[model samples]
Target chain A: MAPTLGKRKRITRDELEQPSRPPSPSSASSESESDSEDVQDIFRRAFEAKFKPLEVDSKKPRVEEVNLELEDQEEEDSDWSGITSDEEEQVQVVEYSHLRHTGDRASKAEQRAFMSSKPPTLSGSTLFKTRPSTKAPADENDLTEASHLKNDVALQRLLRDSHLLSSTSTSGTSTPTLSAVGSQRHKSTDLHLLSLGAKSSIHAQKNMPMSHRIGISAKAKEREERRRAEAKENGVILEKERRAKKFTKERERGVGGPGVGKFRGGTLSLSKKDVRDITSSGGGRGGKGKGKRGRR
Target chain B: MTDETTQTLLKFTGHRHLPSRLLLSTLTGRPIRISQIRPNNVSRQGLQPHEVSFIRLLDSITNGSKIEFGMSGSTLVYRPGLITGSAEGLGASGGVLRHELGRGCEGRGVSWWIIPLCILSSFSKGHMNVIFHGEGCVTGAHPVSGDLSVDSVRTAILPLYKQFGIERDIELRVLKRSCAPSGGKSAGGEVQIVFNHQVRLPKTLHLLNPGRVKRIRGVAYAIGVGGSNNARSIESARGVLNKFVPDTYIFSDVSGAPFIQTPNDKNNPSGKKKGAVGFGLSLVAESSTGCLYSADVASPPEGGTTPEDVGRQCAYQLLEVIQQGGCVSRSAAETVFCLMAMGSEDVGRIAMGRDVIASENTIQLGRDLREFGGAGWGFRDKGEGSEEVVVSVVGRGVGNVGRKAV
Candidate 1:
């Protein structure tokens, strides 16, 4: 039990030391190696800040009182062992592919995602760690076995290779697109457009469609909408098209404004049809200035 | 009232119960004289915009109704018309036909004027298809004030009016909504109502136990301001109301151009400087028994009133009204109670009617209105210690004098 305990602690320590997989397994080996240095520092500092204190206070023996005895620990170990291997491999794939996504530098930034979930990886590693004897053979087999499987997938390999090739081909490739995506994510809301008397959502409203479907339905609709908005601004009362656009936008928003109309008292730009509807219904009477009919 | 006391009752101290007295006089064919209107005031004269507009409204509704004001404008003499609407004017649906009929309401007038007009329409000679135009009117008095007031009137008055068999034809349709004190002639409020199917009387609004306020419906309105004003007011109103009724909703009615216009902007057709931007809230609560109680509050254009303040203030006003514990909301209590004072006066009729319910506000208002109108009934309470009083009046049972004696 003591031997296994020492081995387990060593494994947990090793995992704490290294979160990024060996750079060799990833397509961007050199970049991962360079990025790993900073990432490892982050992971180490995080574990020291968050986990070491717990181990000192909890001291595995007291932890057993909470039913996490050796056998339970072994079970927990087995549990984490099974999943962490897979997580490490999948995370490698994701990191490598994304490295391919925004170019060389941003891969370093994601390496900074250690900032986001620094504590998260600490728990994942501690949840399962095996002796070096078991870990080496198993880790190698798991690494090679699963690593080959990613190669067998044409799409992932293509994406990973493409991102690598793109970055190597152009040193100036990623910063702009990456910042744009960042800005899009942080834009808070789009309610500053000065809509009067609109029943807008009080929540963080999502106006743009974030879907990645083939048709880019929202994008096309937006383009169509821009043109119509431009036309409307030019005082073009395209009633048929305006209604359609209003309905579509309203549908997307899950909130609707009082329909298009002149602000009898509100600031609405009414269509001729609305005006006609009122006049047709016998409303245009006595509207020619105030009447003094019954008054002296 | 006999000939002698009527003169004493004709005079009132201030203009508080002016509408009530005017309505009561018109209902019973009683002539009334009032004095000292805003006598102790400065800056503004005897009749504020709403009062003068109301007087003009009364003149339009009743033919030959004579309203004489003293040169100082502190005193008034009112001789009501001998009823003149005919039931034949009510279309097949017991509503006024699609005819062009309405009066004008001025800038200082609020949409609340519809209450008395609704009451009058119910009992007028012909189906009074009167239209009203006002400063807030887009086309006419089309209720652009962004309020739940008209619906509140319907809910509160329907039960009271149901007793008189004048139930079906009470239609109040908003044709246009115009925000007041802005948009000049371009924006105005307009409304048309159909009533007086046969001058059927209302049942006594006796003890219609005000059921628990099931839910509240409201409107948060802002004029010449950004849309956020309505939202902020609604949020703040909900903050206080969350204490008493969790089930409340105040829809926003933010109007005017999204951009503030400078006075000299060419788009400013009215040429008049836009008045201070305004924010207001109107709320109506419907009870379990379908009775409605309502309250309205507005921000003084330059009072530095915040959205939260308007909302909290409106909520407090509503709470004060609901606490009065009567069938009629505090705002409409006087109007309902005055009609109750002139209802079918048979003892059995009174007994069968909703128990003569009156609250502190209603009792006070009824007393003032009746005193000034020089007509009233003997009021009884369920013993002295209790504040609740049951009002009883042998109704004048006014009929249509225009019916050719048929």
Candidate 2:
């Protein structure tokens, strides 16, 4: 197949070289005698039927002229025959059986692994040295691992916020899947924060007027009382209500104030509790046993 | 505690395998009395300077160790002490122990002390960080005494400790490189070893299979010599090793000669003189199973060989070590066996070449362990017509006494 391809390429090259040959005398001779040319064309057609077709101006006349010129040259050139046969020389095939490195060249990571102060491990210099291999299989593995992590995070988020989805659906939101919209998104975030041990809701107001706070508490208490009374009348069991603990506020004292009472404008004032404590014989805790102290 | 004072000291004669004997005594907390140390040598009898230096090093690391030497220095008694390592106020400053080897210790390489010290460091109570420096520290392989180069110890021996669960923070840093001194010259090499991993008991090792060698890595170091020596050695070594293992790479390290103070010299009392200078090659062949085989060669002290010869000799030596067919090389066998014996009370097995097992040092070590009250080794031929032998050693269960309660 290769030999035939080479021969066809040579024929094409000959066609290209034809115009550069100064319109050789062979073409002129063929035009002068139409009878002989017709005979030659008929023979060529028969030969083309049996085998490969021949060129119109074959290289025989040019080669004869070149041979005559070579024969007239010096005798020293007689021993040398130019243009040997076109058969390709037998390729001197040299096969090496020794193991050869066919992969990428040694990288910097491998150099570091081997040249570091630490002893080079078996897999360090050879197999897994290249930390950023980025090959097909390794890249595929990394992609799958990353996707798995992403999916895991998504699953955890879904489970944690499933109740929010149900509550939003009952409220008649249009897009009621795992995704929350607008206010529902804020509610979802609040719930997530609360689950993560937030002390108070983000929506809780930090400061308000005293009357407004009192009115709000009173209204909430009245609503609870009404619900409980209605539940009792209807003979329906209801969960126990939780009461918020109340904190007592003590009076603030300055750093240099009297121990028992406040000092107001260069005057020291004491309360009845402070006087009873001062009259007692023992210290603060011992003052509880006032009768024993009096007997003593 | 009272009975420890009344315990009889194990008695032995001659100075053969003195380092191993001392190491075992320290590990097992047994006192030993060795007599007749080169008693017949009229010129230089008794313990050599290096031996005395080793004893001094031991004394500095340990506390309350009682040592007694006879008038002639031929008879000696060493009562073992707790392995304290480089504790504060015990010949250590700032957590590092500095030991200076004098000029008399130039006959033996520094590895002669380091290898044994490493074995003891594993069982020490605290971290062992030691810097060995001075005129006698030869970091290269000893051409006459056959001690391994510091590179081989760091690359080959230290890696084996990982199998025993003692791999953390372990490093051997060669601060200055110097070859063995020729004639009366001195070597001013500096080396530091940081072994911060101390274990109550080294994990039992059961290594049997020595897999095929897959790659060869090496370091060709030239000190106070032309850099072309490194290239020449790497070329010749590769010429030999590339035929078998095509994955071979050798790194070249070039450094200038070290300078040390010549204090006692009358001509230049305050001046500094250059130390030994030469080139060397250390080759390590790692097997598929993480086993390592190493070979070391350096320029001889008399200095008549070419770098090519040194490289070719080292490559062939590495091939011979690989052909020995074991999970550990002969140079590291002592450390492996000692750690095995000092492990937990369980049987640990290792496959070694027959020649390695039959070596005199191995036989002497077996004897020394028995004398130190450790269990004897059990040996059997590795099956399937292999020349390797499987050796089984049982631990004494008496690991680091300082860490026993912990």
TM-score of each: 0.48, 0.73
Error of 1 at B138 (Å): 12
Q: Write the per-residue lDDT of candidate 2 for residues B2-66, one digit (tens) a residue.
A: 56657799998998899899888888888899999999999889998889889988987887777
lDDT of 1 by residue, A1-296 (tens): 01222223323433332353332232223444556556765765776687442222212333323422443466666644222222221221223332111121223333332212111121112222464573455667798988788767645434434544445347664543322233332231222221323365344345645565425766878888998899889987765754344443323322355543534566677577775655654554554435422111
lDDT of candidate 2 over A1-296, digit per residue (tens): 13222212122222233322233455333333444445545766787799665445444556644544553462245543343333322332457776554332346677666666665554454455457755666677799998999999888878877887888778784657877667767877888899899999888778999999999989989999999999999998899887777775566666765676658788888777667756664554553554543111
- Cα deviation at B281, candidate 2, in Å, is 1.0
Using Cα atoms, each model's DockQ against the true complex is 0.01, 0.24
Please give the range of 10 consecutive residues that has the lowest summed lDDT in model 2 chain B: B1-10
Error of 2 at A286 (Å): 21
Sort candidate 1 into its docking category: incorrect
How would the docking of model 2 be graded? acceptable
**Which lDDT values do the candidates have, in the order given?**
0.52, 0.82
Off-target runs (Cα >4 Å) in candidate 1 are A1-296, B1-16, B35-50, B69-75, B85-108, B136-166, B169-198, B257-276, B347-365, B368-394, B398-406
* Fraction of true interface contacts that also occur in model 2: 0.36
Chain B TM, per prediction? 0.70, 0.98
